[model samples]
Target: MLKNKNIILGVCGSIAAYKSAFLVRLLVKAGANIKVILTPDGANFITPLTLATLSKNPVYTQYFDEETGVWSNHVELGLWADLILIAPISANTLAKLATGICDNLLTAVYLSAKCPVYVAPAMDLDMWKHETTQTNIHQIQSFGNLIIEPGDGELASGLYGAGRMAEPEEIISFLDHAIKHSMPLYGKKVMVTAGPTYEAIDPVRFIGNHSSGKMGFALADELARLGASVTLIAGPTAQKENQILTRIDILSAQEMLNACTSIFSEMDITIMCAAVADYRPKVIANQKIKKQADSLVLELEKTVDILATLGKSKKANQILVGFALETHDEENYAKGKLAQKNLDMVVLNSLNDKGAGFKSDTNKITIFNKALECTVFEMKSKTAVAKDICTAILKILK
Candidate 1:
C-alpha cells in the first residue's frame, strides 16, 4: 500500500529512537520514498548520519544550516509527504503537537502537513499513564491523527509497563491500512460477528469450540482503517484491538444472535465471522456439577441461526458475507451454505490445511460467491487476509 508514496518520518528523543532505523528500512522496502526529520534531542539517541545512510537521503536536523546558509522548507516537506509518521513521540513532543507548538522543524512540518499524520508514542510507563500525557494523546487523536498505541514490556528505565513503542512490523501494517482510506467503503457501516459461542453447562464449565476470533477482529480493524464505521459482535476470546473498535460483547449463541439481529438492518455490510455453536445444553446448572461415578446425560437444543435470520431480512443493497470453517469437504460445504444462507459470499477455511485454522495468526481462505466463482488465497497474517477480504467486498460493491 505504501508503493511509490512519499513518506516523512519524524524521529523524537527517546530510547526507542533506535527503532526508527528499522522503521525506515521497512517503509523503504515497502516502496515508500523516504524523508527523515530528526529533532535535536533525537540526535542524542541516534545519529543523523545513521538515519541518512539507511534512508538514502539527507536527514533534516535543523530549520537552517549555518555553514551552508540554506533553509529546510518545512512547508515544502509537508506538502511532499503522503503520510508523516512520528515514532518515539515523547510526551513533550505530543504536548507540543496537541497545543500547536511549532518550536522545531518536526513540529513545524507536522503543523503544515496536509497528509495523514501517525504517532507511535514511546515514554516511561508512568509518563504514559499520567493524566497530562493521556490528554495530549486524546487531543492528537481528536484531530484525526492516528496514534499507534505503545506496547507493554520492559522499558528503558527498567520499569516494566506499557510505554514501549510497537514493533516496526506492526507499525508498517498500520501504515499500510491508513494509506488505503480512499475506498468508498471507507466511511460505510460494517457489522461483524466473530469467535466461538460458549454454552454454559455449569458455573465452572462450558461447551465451546476452538475459535480464536482472529479473522473477525482482523476484518473489523481492516474495515475501520478503510474508513468504515465497524461494530464487531465478538464472542469469548482474548483478542485485542488492532484499530479503534466498537466491540459488542456476547456469550452464548443466543446472545450473539440478539446482538447481530439488533444492528444488522442498519449495516451496509454484515460479515458473519463467528463460529457459533450449533447447539447448547437444554438445562444449564446454576452451580458446578460435582464429579460422579455415573455417566451424565444432558439434553441439547438447537441454537439461533444468526446468519440465515439476517439473510431473510436483508435489504436489496446490503451485502452479507458468511464464513464456513469446515473439517471435511470444505468447498462443497461452503458452497452449499452460500446458497442455503443467502450469503453474497462465503469464506471457506479448511482445518485440513496446515496453519489455516483456529487460534493461529495465519489463515488461508477460499471465497465462494453466489456467481459460482471462487478465489483462493495463500496463508498469511490475519491482517493481510483482511485486506484481501475487504478487496472482495469492494469488488461486490463496484
Candidate 2:
C-alpha cells in the first residue's frame, strides 16, 4: 500500500532517534519515496549523513543552505508529501507542535501540511505521565493529528514503564490500517434500522422488546466514520447519538417500514438491526379498556418483515445485512433466515451468550455469508463489535 507514496520522516532529539534509521529503511523497502527532516539537536544522536545515505536524498535540517545561501521552503516540502510521520517525538517537541510553535523546519512543515500527520511520542516515564503532557496530547489529537500510542518497556531513563516508542514493524501496520480506514465508504449511502418497534394494543399500551438501540446506533456511527451518509431509522428508544446522522424517529414497526421503503432505492447498503415486533393487535382499542374482565384476549396479526422486504427487492449493487437474535437452534435459525431473505450477510447474536443480548453495552456475534462461511467473535464492547461488522462489509464490497 505504501508503494511510490511520498512520506516525510521527522526525527527529534531523543535516544530513540536511532530507531528512525530502521523506520526509514522499512518504508524505502516498501517502495515509498522518503524525505528525512531532522531537528537541530537530533543529529547529536544520529548523523544526518547516515539517514541521507539510506534515503538517497538530502537530509533537511535548516532554513537555508550554509554554502549557497539558498533558503529551504517548508511549504513546498509539506505539499510534496502524502503523509508525515514524527517518530520519537520528544516532550518539548510535542508541546511545541501542539501549541503551533514552529521554531524548526519540521514543526514549520507540520503547520503547513495538508496531509495526515502521525506522531509517535518517546519520553521519560515521568514526562509521559505528567498531566500537562496528557493535556497536550489531547490538544494535538483535537487538531487532527493521529497519535501512535507508546508501548510500555524499559525507557532511556533505565526505568521500566510506559514510555517506549513503538517498533518499526508495528508503526507500518498502524499506517496500513489507517490507510484502509480513511474514507473507505466515501460516496456510499447507507441506511440503518435501530431500537425495538412498538406494536400497539391500545392508545396507551404497546408490546415492545428490551432493545436499547446501542448496537444499531453504534453501527450507524461506525458507518458514518467510514464516510457514509447514514440514514438512521429509529424506533422509540431512549438512545441518543452525537454524530450528525440523518435520524428519523418512529413509533411502530409499520411506521419504521414506511420510512425505510421510501429511501430503500437510494441506499447502497442497508443494515437491519432493529428488533421489530412480529405481531400487533388486529383491532386497536380507541381508548384504554376498562378493568372489567378477568383476563384479556386480543386478536393479533403479522407485521411487515422489513429486512425480508428489502432483501427481496434489493438491486444487484445494493447490499442488505440482516441481524438475527436467536434463542434456540441459533446457527440454523440464523442461517435459515439469511437464505430465506436473500440477504448478503447475516449477523447472529444468541440470547444464550451471557453478555450478548439486548439492553447490554456489549455483545458477541457470528457473521454468516451466502456461502455459509462464518466468523465468530468473542464478547466485546458494542463499539468494537460494530467495527468488526464494518470491516466484514467492506471486504464483501471489495
Candidate 3:
C-alpha cells in the first residue's frame, strides 16, 4: 500500500527509538521511499548510520551537512513528503511541537509541511499519563496532527502501562490509510459494537461468551483509517485502544442495546459486531448462588433485539450492518437474518473454519449485501480484515 510513497520518518529521543530501525526497514520493504530525520537526543539510542542503511536514504541530523557544507533545506524536505510521521515521539518533542518551537530541522519542516503529520508518542508511564503530556497531545490534535496512541505494556522504566510506541506493522497500516484519502467512506461517521456482553448473575459472577472482540475492533480501526469518525461501543474485553477509536464501554446486552439506541440515529453507518447474549437470567442473586443442589435451573428472558430495532428506525442516509455466526446451514441462516434484520449488509463466519472465529486473532468473512450478493475474503489479520470491511462500507456509502 505504501509503494513508492514519499515519507519522512522523524525519530525523537526515547528508549523506543531502537524500534525505529525495524520500522524503517518495514516501511522500505513495503516499497516506501523514506528519508529519516533524527533528533540530536535520539542519536544516543540509535545511530544515524543504522537507520540510513535501512531506509536507503541519507539521515538528516542538522540544518547543514558539516562535511559537504550543503544545507538540508527544511522547506524542500517538507514539500517533498507525502506524509510526515514522528515515531517514538518523546514527551519533550511533543511539548515542543505543541508550543510551535521550531528550533530543529524536523520541527521546522513539520511547521512548513503541507502533508499530513502523524505522531506516535513514547515515554515512561508517569510521563505519558501526566496532564502536561495529555495537553500536548490535544494541542497536536488541534493543530491537525493525527496521534497514533501508545500501546500499554511493560515500559523501559519497569512499570506496566501505556507508554510504548505502536509496532511497525501497525504504523505501516496507518500510513496506508492516510495515503489513500480517496476511499468512498471518507468523512463518514461509523458505529461499531464488539466483544461479549456480561449478564450479571451476581456481583462477581456473570454470563459471558468467548468473544475476543477482534472483529469489531478491526472494523472500527479500519473505518477510522478510511477517514471516518468511529464510535466503538465495546463490551467487556482485554483490548487496547488504538489510534482509530472513540470508544464507549458497556456491560450486559441491555447496556449494548442502550448504547446502540442512543447513537444509531446520528451515524452514517453502524456495524453490530458484538456477541450479545440472546437471553439473560430472570432472577438476580444478591450473592453467589450456593451449591445447595446438584443441578440448577434458572429462568431466562429474551434480550432486546438491537439490530432489528435499529433497522426499524434507520434513516435513509444511514446504513446498518449486522453479523451472523452460524454452526449449521450457515448461508441460509445468515441470509435469513440479513433479510429479517433489514441490514444493508451482513458478515457471516462459520465456527467450522479454524483460526477464523471467536477468541481468535484472525477471521475469514463472507459479506452479503441487501442484493444477496456475496464477497468472500481469505483469512487475514484483524487489521487487514478491517480494510475489507471498510471497503465494503465505502461501497455502501457510494
Candidate 4:
C-alpha cells in the first residue's frame, strides 16, 4: 500500500532510538522512499551510516555543512514529504515541539510540514507520568498531530511503565491502514493515454507528430500519487516513466486503440491526452522509396478515432476527459470535441499562446464541461496544470 510513497523518518535521542532502524528497514522493504533526519543527540545514539545505507539516501543531521556551507532548507523538506514520522521523540524534543521551538532540524521540519505529522514519544516512567509531559503531548495532539502511544514495557531506567516507543511492526501496520483509508482515489482504477502515434510508411520511415508526452505522463503520476491504480497507454515518445503504474508502450495508433478498447470498460476514469495521427499512409511500401522522382506522393487514409470510439462505450459512472490543441477558434473546437466525443470535460490548449504547445515544459489551459462551463487557467508548469485538471475531474466525479 505504501509503494512509491515519499516518507520522512525523524529519529530523536532516546534509548528507543535503536528501534527506528527496524522501522526504517520495514518501511523501505514495503517499497516506500525514505529520507532520514537525525537530531544531534539522536546521532550519538545511532550511527548515520547505518540509516543511510538502509534507506539508500543521505541522512540529515545538521542545518548546514561547515566546509561546503550548503544549508538544508527545512521548508522544502517539509513540502517534499507525504508523511513525517518522528520515532523515539525524547521528552526534550516533545516539549520543544509543543512550545513551538525550532532548535533542531527535525523539529523545524515538523513545524513546517504541509503533510500529516506523526510522533512516537519515548521516555522513562517518571518522565512519562509527569504532568508536564502529558500536557506537552496533549498540546501537540490538539494541533492535528497523530500521537502513537508508547507501549507499556521495561524502561531504559530499569522501570516498567507506558513509555516505550511502539513496536516497528505495529507502527507500520497503523500507517498502512491510515494511508489507504485517507486516500480519495484509493480504490478507483484510472486510465490515461499520452504521446504521439507513428504510422509506418516503410521499414525505414514513419509518420508522427511533435508531442513529447510530458502532460500525459504528469497526469498519470498525479493520479497514482493520489492512490489510483493507473494504467498508462503511451505512444512512441522519449518521456521518462514514473514508477507505481501499469504502463503499456505502443508505437502505432492501431496498437493504442487495441490496448484502450480492451480495458476501457473496467476503468472508472479515462484521460485521452495523446495526439493521435488523424491520417496514415494508405499502404506500406515493400521497400524504401528511392530518390528517383523529384516529386512523390502517398495516399492518406483516415485513422480510427480512438477517443470517439471509447466515448461511445463509456458507462454512466465512467468519467471521460479529452484534450484539444488548437491555433484558432480553440474554445469552439474544444466544445465541439466535448460533445462529439461524449467527454465529461475537455482540456483545451492553444498553440497561439507561447510556452503552451508541443514539447514545451509549461502550458496554459481552459476546461469545458458538458454544461459548457468554462474555467480558464494561467500559464503554469505542466505539474501544476495536471493538479488543476485533477481537481476538475474530482469535481465531476463528485
List the lowest-lDDT window of 10 residues for candidate 2: 175-184
Candidate 3 lDDT tens digits, 143-210: 88999988999999899999999998888888777666655566678899999999988777888899
Residues 1-398 of candidate 1 have per-residue lDDT tens digits of 67677999999999999999999999889878999999999999999999999999999999999999999999999999988999979999999999999999999999999998999999999999999999999999999999999999999999999999999999999886766566467668999888999999998889999998999999998887677888999999999766666999999999998888888889999999999999999999998899885888889999978889998998889999999888987888999988888889999888998998899999999998789799989999988999999999999999
> What ordering of candidates by lDDT runs from best to worst?
4, 2, 1, 3
lDDT (Cα atoms) of all candidates against the true structure: 0.91, 0.92, 0.89, 0.92
Local accuracy of candidate 2 as per-residue lDDT tens digits, 1-398: 57677999999999999999999999999888999999997888999999999998999998998898988899999999999999989999999988989899999999999999999999889999999999999999998899999999998789999989999999999986786567789779999999999888888899889999999999998898777889999998898975667999999999999999999999999999999999998999999988898999999999998888988899999999999999999999989988899899999999999999899999999999878899999999999999999999998899
Compared with the true structure, model 3 gives a TM-score of: 0.61
Q: Which stretches of candidate 2 lie over 4 Å from their true place?
A: 1-115, 118-182
lDDT of 3: 0.89
TM-score of model 2 (CA atoms): 0.60
Candidate number that wins on TM-score, 1 or 2: 1
TM-score of each: 0.61, 0.60, 0.61, 0.79
Q: Candidate 1 or 3, higher lDDT?
A: 1
lDDT of 3 at 219: 82
Q: How many collisions per candidate?
A: 2, 0, 0, 0
**Model 3: worst 10 consecutive residues (lDDT sum):** 178-187
